[model samples]
Target: MEIDQAGKTNGQQPLFPTPSSTPPPPPPPPQISLSLKRLLTIVNCLLLCLGNAGGPIIVRIYFLHGGHRQWLSAWLETAGWPLLLFPLSLSFLYRRRSNPSAPAVLITPRLILASAFIGLLTGVDDYLYAYGLDFLPVSTSAVLIATQLAFTALFAYFIVRQRFTPYSINAVALLTVGAAILAMHASSDRPAGVSVGGYWKGFVLTLGAAALYGLVLPLVELTYSKAGQPVTYTLVMEMQLVIGFFATAFSTVGMIINKDFQALTREAANFGLGETKYYLVLSFAAILWQCFFLGAVGVISCVNTLLAGILIAVFIPMVEVLAVVFLHENFSIEKGMALVLCLWGLASYSYGEYREAKEKKEQIASPQVQTSAV
Candidate 1:
């Protein structure tokens, strides 16, 4: 009877294991909540805006207070970039000890060389920007920098294969028009201390700075995409560290060659704000500029180069407002129009993003629904 019962149970078992013996399905992969991601993006954008706006203001204040140390300021700003090293070091140690087989943060010498080359360009870019700001009002400099958005869009299209929807086209067009208006009207409201010749020099230099930075943004995107591995925040920061190291090295050489380092002591002693405040201003400016650099790069990693450029462009008006309040610069009618147009372009881009996201969600959901129905 027992053998008969065992045979009956075995027959019932069939070819598959019983439910109790079957293994459970694996857990779903971890993911950041959509809302959290959006919130983080917003926070990063705000920080980027604030840092960009404030860095210039601090430098302007230094100059306003009779600080003629252009090279010093530029060097300090580039020098602070090494602050990224601490985090990068931690990442390396963690990866080595915890995940011995994981890919190194930036292992290839060719990649390092490429990043350093970009950093050298960035160092030159920073000096030009500083040279411009030394001669131009903060408001005018901000306007010129806005031109970077157009250049960034152009480069992104060619280099990254970023597709431009009609909305993005409209955004780019409007932004360009607004910048042109600003440039045309730029001569009308020269700051009290600046001369016509200086203004033009500043204008040209600032535009050059913008163009170089535009190239930098797209090239960064290209480098990461070509990395042959998935890019992460750690990798992004590591790239920044490499770039910063090279940039700082270049600037340090410039400082030494120009004897800017030798003049630093005398400049500090003769500073209008006194020696301590003068050093403080330089320190703060350097740190703030690094913050802006990091924030911009972070934004690029999180979104795209075009979006990062747009965010910077959008904040130009805020920088203008700040210039008006603190630096006593003019806010002409053209500048007002520029601000309005920037807002409009931002809205259009945002709407396009929303539509694209919606379509993607629908596409993903449709497949699931069809499978369930079947």
Candidate 2:
């Protein structure tokens, strides 16, 4: 018999006696390489860039080509959520390969609830955005969307304790100015027949969408932090899937109430772009907006919400280009100057991020070098 650390008697003596109360330290969190993180970040950034550039253009085309139902357009944003299953299936395959006994689902009930709440908010944002698009030009809406970065920063600071550098501040200021530039002459670039009140309404709605979405981003980051389960990329995708389903459901309810579903067939039949093109545009909207959201969450999982917002703000200028080339929009001198300022701000932010990363890498290397010298 031996006395254990807890003052309990052990009936059987062991070859090596250890104190029962001396428990082993918990396992450390998994360590991923910075290079791998950067790679994933780049891939997600590319996705965000593509979706940001193409998604809005596709949706704008719907309105320009005779789409009149805002709820229908909003529905399309999350309707393509099922497309995430392809990648999720791949993730499932890898998980089973790595560990045959792994559970079918990684996300917990808590994460699902959080994701659903956020998805509801996303649904509201979707409607606001779609309604805004019905009246505003894509370029103007995009510049307004750029203001999301400012809101994202403000919310992120409080939500996730995000710290900003001077460069990010400068970027925010420049983009704020760019958005304000449009406000100065609100009526100057109004589409042919959009009424003064209607344009202002769109402006306010889009700004609301931007601010709401800004809050949404930080909330998402907070969810990731609080999710009881380890937040893997696959789990992040699953959460996104849940979010999309709820958002689509939210819009579906609106579509029912507004009779947008009944109007869909009629609108499709008489669309300016032809019935074939009308359906095609809807299909594209579904796919493109899914791309936008998946990319957004992917970026958040890889890094933080701030970077995701920054990436979005950086590429809005590209939307202006697409608006001019494909939609034949009027890109005025004011927008051109705004474009330059936006680019300049993005450049500053990028340089700052690069410097910070470099400093961190050097700091890590110095410790290893000192150890090797010893």
**Pick by TM-score: which candidate is best?**
2
| Maximum-lDDT candidate | 2
Q: After superposition, how far is residue 252 of candidate 1 from its true place, in Å?
A: 1.3
Tens digit of per-residue lDDT, candidate 2, span 197-247: 999899899999999999999999999998865777788889999999999
CA lDDT of every candidate? 0.82, 0.87
Q: What TM value does model 1 have? A: 0.85
Error of 1 at 362 (Å): 1.2
